[model samples]
Target: MHQEKFSKSTRTNKQVALHTDVVVVGGGLAGVCAAIASARSGAKVVLVQDRPVLGGNASSEVRLWALGATSHMGNNNRWSREGGLIDEIMLENLRANKEGNPLIFDAILLDKVVAETNITMLLNTAAYSVTKESANRIESVNAFCSQNSTYYSIFAPIFTDCSGDGIVAFNAGAAFRIGSEDKYEFNELLAPEKANSDLLGHSLFFYSKDAGTPVEYKAPAFAYSQDEIDAIPRSKNIGAKDSGCKFWWLEFGGILDTVHDTEEIKWELWKIVYGIWDYIKNSGKYEDVENLTLEWVGTVPGKRESRRFEGEYMITQHDIVEQKRFDDAISYGGWAIDLHPAEGVYSEKPACSQYHSKGVYQIPYRCFLSRDIENLYLGGRIISATHMAFGSTRVMITCAHGGQAIGEAAAMCAKLNVKPKALLAPKLMSELQNRLNGLGHGLAGIPLTKSDVLLKAEIQASSTLALAEFSQQDDWLSLAQSAAQLLPFTAGLAPTFTVQLSAQEATTLTCQLRVSIKPENYTPDLICKTIELDLHAGEQTVSLDFSEVELITQYGFVIFLANDKVQVRTSAQRVTGTMSVFNKVHKAVSNNGKQIAPPNSGVEEFEFWTPERRPMGQNIAMQITPALQSFAVSNLTNGHLRPWLGSNAWVADLSDKAPTLTLSWPEKQTLAGLRLYFDTDSDHALETVLMVHPEKRIPFCVSRYSIKLEDGTVLMTEGDNYQTLNTIYFKQTISTDKLIIELSHPAENVPASVFDIEVF
Candidate 1:
């Protein structure tokens, strides 16, 4: 090998020139996703992050929990988890760290980016300068890494601005709006009467730990007084165990510029945090906080709103509320229009104003590409949307989905050697949608029709379909002293309930069925039915048939395992429409020598857990029949829109035996692969605010299935699937005119639904 000269003749330190197919600025969830998506699609990518960590607000520095479609759970739009790369990250986190630890999640995100060979990550590098070849095309971006005191000039054919602040777009001279839009501009009721510079503001959160003993506290110089705390409307919401984020109302600098005044905003937030903590501990009002101490406080305030770049289409509040369908839709969002007052903590009103959508809304590809810059794309919170619309789409999961779309689009642009605007062509847009759908990305109303042999065939199913799972099983569950499983029940009468349990040793146990007076909080307050039993060491079934128990509200079944040796059986299969609740127990015993049970004393004391809630992956086992319905088999190839909770997919009637679906074509067609999209409760967002769901796969997913060609020719038999999308490629090409699919319910007497089926 020949070696060159050590130094250049002209300069001491020169800029490092790095070339890539695509350059992504910022390493937040959006940037990470963009880089990953691009790399996966055969593009050389360079991901530049200003911070050392990958997650932006979700990282340890900011400590904001990831939110997305789950934000609209109680607002009629349920089970709307952002699919694709975001889902992959969530599922990986659920498998590794179900506790939702930010540090562990940070590592998970970092590992995901680093694992991609085509992605070159430059942490601690900030992109500040943009080089454009023409008026509309960005040629390169210059970033400085202060850690090594090195300047990097990264050249790329395509660029994605996933930076939450839209730094790349701003520097590239892309047209963008800094604040709210006028109501008349977008015809949005939520928008201000006239355009304003007010923003959603920034926030910093802190966590507290129990010190086991009384801890003395001193107020800082800028600490807020008890009188000042009393001025706020929701001051009573704070508690000893409450985190700083819970007081999201503690925001500031909305009236000021969120970017230029960031430092000022951060300083003010710190003062507020210390003041809030001081009032809670030293005010002598909250005696329960005597043992708690501040464990960690965020230095960098997590930003909510900033520069929103202009694109071919600007999403408005009407699009979200009406749930508009777009022909070029690439991703979807379902979070309610959660708009907060500009006067954060100072405001006397509630923290936010929420407007829910009829259901999840589709985000079009037109919103991802910059209107003026041909080579530039926008993602994350900076996508093209009015302030009111951004309230829903700005969520991290939605941003992550947007990032994935732009990444895929960037890869396509680089491959085709065309500008992003070129992809807007009908044929190209369809190709992009098909590719995204094939990869399990969100495109609500758009069906996968490109080269889909199943789309051209006639379909028939064996029986009428069921919308939801109708089976119930008694499985094993470990019960804490203050734990209660919440299930949806009719309010009028107490029906016969059957529960099976097994004890390690002979023990006495009490089972109480209580009515949740506060359905919102899911508290087991009023006792409707109770049963006392002496459980044996082995398995035993207890049936309680109560007559005329006046149930006024939703029901919660609480099991009191007085003896630590007893364990109740819970359904191993996940029930999508129900939820469970566990009370926050500081100690096993109460002030008296009695074991603590749920609905202990206060209204906000219990931690409610819903079905598909993360961390607790499995649902509580109970004896009840789920409502069922019949669905068409043709819906299997009708695209990936779950309009109602269980409406879009092809639902089969409740059957213990396997049901068959047949696809017949007029003539033999060459087939190389097959793709199946199952109904795994796509609407049920499977991650939790504090805990991750234990299992990503639902009971309705086709765990066991077989496929055969015409004349009884075996194609694939006895296959298992656990993901939302399952793709199978045959080793050898198979030519067939007809295909038969046999599916079995994973649970007893349950129904299975096929969201989409494709033959390539």
Candidate 2:
């Protein structure tokens, strides 16, 4: 190669022009999901990411865990995992990289993107400019890749900005808000008394490992002095065993512009990180840190709040706290309204203030569409939400769930040859919701419609679960705190529940039968009945009969008040739609047993009844006088998935051998695909990082299954399944009058359960 002669003028970099149906900006979990969903929905997609890897805050560079509605299962929301593409990604990560290694997570995301043939992924490319066709619509986006010295001009009919900072929409002239709104503006009591410029800050994390010998560290010139470190109110929280996001409060630059001042924030965070490390190694405060060495430090800080674009509707604090239902509901969120102080690590105030809602609230499609730029779609933290509401919706997985909806909407827009606003029509909105729910995207209160074949078929199962008893096992748990067994009930007289208990001495146990004010919610806010039981020193059975009280069809909590002297028997058996919850606090999320908001704060006060993590959260051992027959084979055609008004899933009895479900139709029908929904224990929080899950595969998820025709010819078989949605497309259409699905129990104790089955 020869060098060119020096000239007075400069040469331009290589330029490339591309066209696609949908263009998704940013490669965070939200954008990654947006691109994948768009590609799966039959749209050509171009994914542009400024970083070298996907999963922005969740990437190795930042190393923040991807969390959403489940809120680490620290709140009242049960079976509340966000579904669709994000769920698939999390399950895949759990299968291959249960250790939650950041590097492994990055590879998994890359693998998922590359597997989608309809998607064109561009890494290390940042979109900096937008070209508008008119005053409202975007014609193309201009981006550059520093590594390749290339400029890319991508044109698309629809554009989705999943960038955390709303870069694309901002450049396209989209209206946005930068700071908290005034309390009177939206009548949101949680809002600041007056409009403020303060915002959540950016944070950096570091990891350490044992070196087995003394390791020395020296503070750099820019590092903070001991006095400066001492100024931080939470400096005492720093410990030798903690790493990564545990120090999420180690933030800075909230008082400044998060987007423009990111560099300044990074430098300050670095100074703090290195300074903290120096103190641990040389300050001689931490004895266990003698053999520890710094394993890694984040190169970039994880940004919390930035530019929030305006859409057709701006979700306010009321919508979240009141569990408002939207006519254009497309997705849902259950994480608490978590907000941090502007002073961050240096503040004397608590690290964060979080308030949880009574239940999961619905998010409308209108919030995802930009009001100013016609073709623009806002996603992630930049979605149309006020500062108070964004605190709950800004989490990565929640944003990813909304991103899937945006991607599907983009596909619909291209198909209909219309703008994002046009989807607001009632009929069109219904279509969008139907399409999203069909793909296993969880929308609160929206049930799937039965397929034509399922509508005409008669479903029968080999055996169905009758809630007769949970046999008492040797395992007995102490009543350290109040514990309750969540059980489904019919709209009639409450059944008699007999529980086995043992006491150190004679003790009186107070039992209360409670239900949520809303039937679909899990929070036990309404007391249905109460009973008093006397326990003996030895193991004895106590019967609680609420026969005098009539009840509506919903989940009833059989609560036993805390009595340290008594112990309740627990069964090892795991059920698909059953769990045991306790009234306790998860200090990690600021849940202090119960929430008591300040007067006129507009936030409701409620007790947090959360479940214990698995390998320990066993069901209570109890027997029903008249066995509850709710898990019928007919539930497969009931439209609803998951546990709603009742157990919508068809669960086979644990005693049944070779469990099978048969669907017979009057006439032969052509079938090309079959979709099965299994129970993945949605209540369990499958956190994407830091926290280690008790099991790689959800204990209730079916591990092996087979589909066959009436003639006993096997159509397909999945041997190592570990997901909620299983779609099996046949190589060729088969005409059959009857279909038989043979299932294997996920475990010996756990029964075989399925939410819904669709044939097309």
Candidate 3:
């Protein structure tokens, strides 16, 4: 085992190296993001991390799932988020591991940190000291690695301490505090009955598997009940060997001593962890399953409480419980004030409560910077906050947002050659807030240079700018990944966000985000989505998928279940398919034509149509032609449907007796055209339906021409035919909303079992 320890060093005074504008200590999520922000803003940066990987708790070290305000339902279907480096991480994961339990989270974090050219990362390094010429300026930062015991210096104008532990801040001569201040500090309702229980806890999480066969295991000699176990009431039933997760075994983080007792707590944690398994197998809980054992043991203990330094804005519990919003709020969090009760130390039930506000609450940027220290900035759990406020804001994922905010601020300071506190000023604070608002997709653009006045600009080649602005009191993490990108580009927050494009370059382009719960949308390759954006033409606020990412990895999903969020790299040999369900009907395509009912095979499924908002009739028409079955195209949002909502993968059923159709193909086959027939069964509200060919197998039903039924007129071909080979088109030309398609044209020999169709 590689024991991570600092070696003996006698040298206190050492020469420091100078480079870059900003130096971020602690390469966790916040540090990584801050580095990216600084580097992207055209400032050089050197990122130092004690550990080898990035992402802090979200990294592989702890392996806790990414938890923010997520709209996820077990990793299925489609979703979106605000884009940035986090979006990039998510997109990479989608490209590598599509299904849930995204395993490559560590690699994804590392890749982003390494990909940027302006940022230099120093791994396996620790920040030992921060030398300052004055409180207003950081002269140098010294880092040491145990591997070499040599101190390396990094000098920068601004320094951000994203080291959740607040080690750097303390070294920088910044006054810091640990534990709770007063019960009224944050005005939290669930604070300690009287005084605050300044205790913060951590857990040793592990993954367990069920053993099919019974196995006996002996406990260690010291594995006996003590005051620790006696105090807290154990369910005695929480541990189940068959269960895949086993955090219930967490028995650390009580009063003996927070830091000094770490090793002892680790020892006690081990006993309870293995003891539960011992009872499971010996106690007969393992009798039902097959082979079972520990799959993974927690490496870095999940620390819930730690040191916190006073920041420019000391976020109070009242700010959270009362839903206090700030005009300069850069990020939002509203997960609820969940207080885990410590039952062992005080001999009382552990405190656990769920508190909700009328709406989301915004976290101000001031909470990220040091108020006393001139050049110091704090991120993650150690940011300036009262005990109760930290209780709500200290979550890893939410803290990551704090990390991102500070990182960006650090970048902004470096680029502007200003201090982080400068950002707290009204003009700068509002600008940063506007930038965040744009990134959140809540508000658009920096509120600089009013839109209406831009139309009368004296400059030549000026387009009529109708920019209007609206701001939402964003307090939900659901939109955390939303609007952080606009400033560096749209507004002058980062200033370098301005791009000088060639005249030939299309103004319209797809903007991919970096991190998201759903990774399918983000891509290293610039996704060539049609551009219709009228920037500088209109000033309007709209919610969009600009920062949302989608991806798929080919080898990750062994057998993809419907609605599973997936990502895949396009391969020439790859085969794909789609399926949809409607009111009382299911539709798909096949080699010959659209199927009346989809084949009852793994390749396809059938669903009967039901009444809906658009329209419905006795049946609906489905079309499959030679034109479909083989094609390479960017992923589309609407091309298929399923019995359940957001099912990315779907099975199709083609049945003429009912409003259902299906299509099938061996591989990529050349198809001429495709024809879809509709009955509007009983509705006309349906306007358009898009088609996607997952299999890339062309449909052979329609020859080289198309047929249009517009105005009840049959035509040899409907509209324009493009370079589409395997896939073809089907639009509602009948001026009606719904349709019933079938493969009754037996002469075409089309089986109607194609699986690529989506109606949105």
RMSD of each: 10.2, 1.0, 21.2
Model 2 lDDT, full chain set: 0.90
Clashes of each: 18, 0, 127
Residue-wise C-alpha lDDT for candidate 2, range 214-252, written one tens digit per residue? 887778899988678867787988887898888888988
Residue range 1-760, candidate 1, lDDT tens digits: 9976766565444579999999999888888889999999999999999998989988878877777876623433344677777877876676577666778888989999989999999999999999999988889999998898889999999999998889889998899998788878767766767898878988888888899998887867876666877766656667756774565667887878898899998988888788778888887777688789888888889999989999999999888866777887888887767677776776665676655554568898899989999889998999999898998899888899889988998999999999998998999998988787777785654655645466678888887543233234544556544345544444456555566677887887877777544442233455777778777888887765654565543434544434567766655444333444444331101111122222321112222222324444355554543322225665576575443322456666665376788888999988887877765655455442354455645556678888887677777765556666777787789888888888887666346667678778
Candidate 1 regions exceeding 4 Å error are 1-14, 218-236, 450-452, 455-629, 641-646, 650-672, 688-697, 703-721, 729-744, 749-752
In the range 28-142, model 3's lDDT, one tens digit per residue, is 6667777776676577889989887777766666654544322111111112222334544443454345432424667767778788888888888888787788875568888
The lowest-lDDT stretch of 10 consecutive residues in candidate 1 is: 586-595
Q: Can you give the TM-score per candidate against the true fold? A: 0.74, 0.99, 0.56
| The candidate that achieves the highest lDDT relative to the unseen native structure | 2
Candidate topping TM-score: 2
Q: Which 10 consecutive positions of candidate 3 have the poorest summed lDDT?
A: 680-689
Q: Which stretches of candidate 2 lie over 4 Å from their true place?
A: none
User: lDDT per model, in order?
Assistant: 0.72, 0.90, 0.45
Order of all candidates by lDDT, from best down to worst? Answer: 2, 1, 3
State in Å the error of residue 272, model 2. 0.6
